[model samples]
Target: MALLGLDSALGATLDPVGVVLALVAGVFWAGYVLTSARVGQLVPGAGGLAMTLVVATLVVAPLGAPRAIGAFGDSALLGLALVVALLSSVAPYTLELSARHRLPAPVFSILLSLEPAFAALFGWILLNQDSGVLRNLAIVLVIIASAGVTLTGARRKAPAMSVEAAGTRRDDA
Candidate 1:
């Protein structure tokens, strides 16, 4: 929808290369989520966040380097970019990975649907982007829906733990 909106409002057309890049991004991100979830299970105590940053840095550098590196000298500019990276990359990655631990992959994808709402809200308050009562309400609706689905799923999974407990033999047995 956002892409459609951009196409309609801005007359922006994606070339074949752009379309391919977008598709590649979607595929890699899906893999990243699944791989993070698997690693999260193995490490037991480690956050999937560090892996996200590591992968992101490596991926972006090769594609974005000359221009991205050129802007790095000024402290103020560097700080701004770092702040954006943390907010856009770090927080969302952590939230997604943490949610993945308890939620099914489909449910995790649902929670991710609310991220645009957050981006919109931030843009409105910080950048004075256009926002109105309807937009705010839409954001609220997405958040509530995501939370309801996540919590309900968590509750359902909780009951399954009893089955595992029942399987454990007592020392007296």
Candidate 2:
């Protein structure tokens, strides 16, 4: 709340439009995380991600394409845009989905919860931005909570696998 400056006040937000929009975005982000796991499972390699990017582009292009098209006429601007997209969006999403595929959902979510810490850290280090005590405390709290969840929240026995499913006969081994 302190950062974007209040999805919630000390008691209430009074339903400000920015807070409402942010809440909606939060809900959509949660859905994206959940669906990204399923997409990783159903599609091999980056195919699912590729399809997602294409669909997202088609959906948003109507809003952005007219403005973006002019940039394409400049080789330097187009190259910078591609670089920014690849570094900021594509690579992170790819790695996030790859981790989501391997980790249990709870663990993945907890790990993702450290996003604020990472963002703050980057801002501090790369941009020389000062994060005040609240942000520092938040980073510490998030790390501790993530550690606790990893240690306790995701416990389970591995499911038994048949040898054929494991891709080897006992005799062959």
Candidate 3:
């Protein structure tokens, strides 16, 4: 709702299909994070990630292979593919696995919400895509919301931990 309101305030109309796709992506990302955390617990991090990439490649191959074969004739395109794969997939997945081990799920999810702001910044810097003032304001709103969630969550957890500690001490006494 806030996102929709922000879009309207920015004088941008939402495409229904794009909105639906974004929602669907959010669901998939939630699933990914939860499953990755479990997988990180059960299997060696790199091994599990290796298996995941292999399965992902197999799944994507039918659609991507034929197009890639045709496109791979261009050496520059091949280089771009390799760089994109490493930068977008390899580095991020590895870091995400490490983060999943360290961060609580809710906090992690809040952190994930900052991706759009980073994307906007990267687009501006790397692709020369300029977001106007209203759009930049929308990005700032997202960052503030994420920070609010994270700080509130941390405060909530601190009390719970202290309560647990008191309970343990009482039991020992």
Candidate 4:
């Protein structure tokens, strides 16, 4: 945030609603990591993911169904939407489910936080979207920090010193 010139919000006013929504999103994300991991463990293969997505679609459809129904009238648009859905939403979730099955929950969740950094990197490389130097530095810092944390979490407690190293040498120097 400091790198984004957020160190000083000279004229900024807090939006309570936005703050609440962001907090809510964070809580939901935490829940998602845990729930997804459990689901992955319980259901082998993509069966769990498929069932979860189906339920999610049913829950979400009411909100978008009307607009979605209209979108079907244009065959090309419908095709485009399907492509977009598969590429952006479904594929990532599938990969996440697969990852959740394999990785430790905390490591998996921490790595997921790198999504924005990777997205920005892709944008810079592929779309010619240059995040300014400070923002770029921030992204690099975040990646480094995430990696450090993940590795640190995986570390065991300090090992007991070998007797030769911890004890005095028997011979004179």
Cα RMSD for candidates in order: 6.5, 6.0, 3.9, 6.4
Per-residue alpha-carbon lDDT of model 1 for 40-156, expressed as tens digits? 877654345686578669977888777777667778888998899888787766766667777776566676877768788789889998755555666676677778877777788
Model 2 lowest lDDT segment of ten = 2-11
Model 4 lDDT tens row, 63-108: 9998899888999999999999899878999888778778875677
* Winning model by TM-score: 3
- lDDT for model 4 comes to 0.78
- lDDT order, best first, reads 3, 2, 4, 1
| lDDT-better candidate, 2 vs 3 | 3
Instruction: Write one digit per residue (lDDT tens) for candidate 2, span 35-141.
Output: 87688878998899999999888898899987988997999999999999999889998898788778877777778888888898899999998777665776777
- For model 1, the stretches where C-alpha displacement exceeds 4 angstroms are 1-14, 102-107, 116-173
Cα lDDT, model 4, residue 162: 79
lDDT of each: 0.70, 0.79, 0.80, 0.78
Local lDDT at 84 for model 2: 98
Give the TM-score (vs. native) of candidate 1. 0.54
Summing lDDT over every window of 10 consecutive residues in candidate 3, give the lowest-scoring window. Answer: 1-10
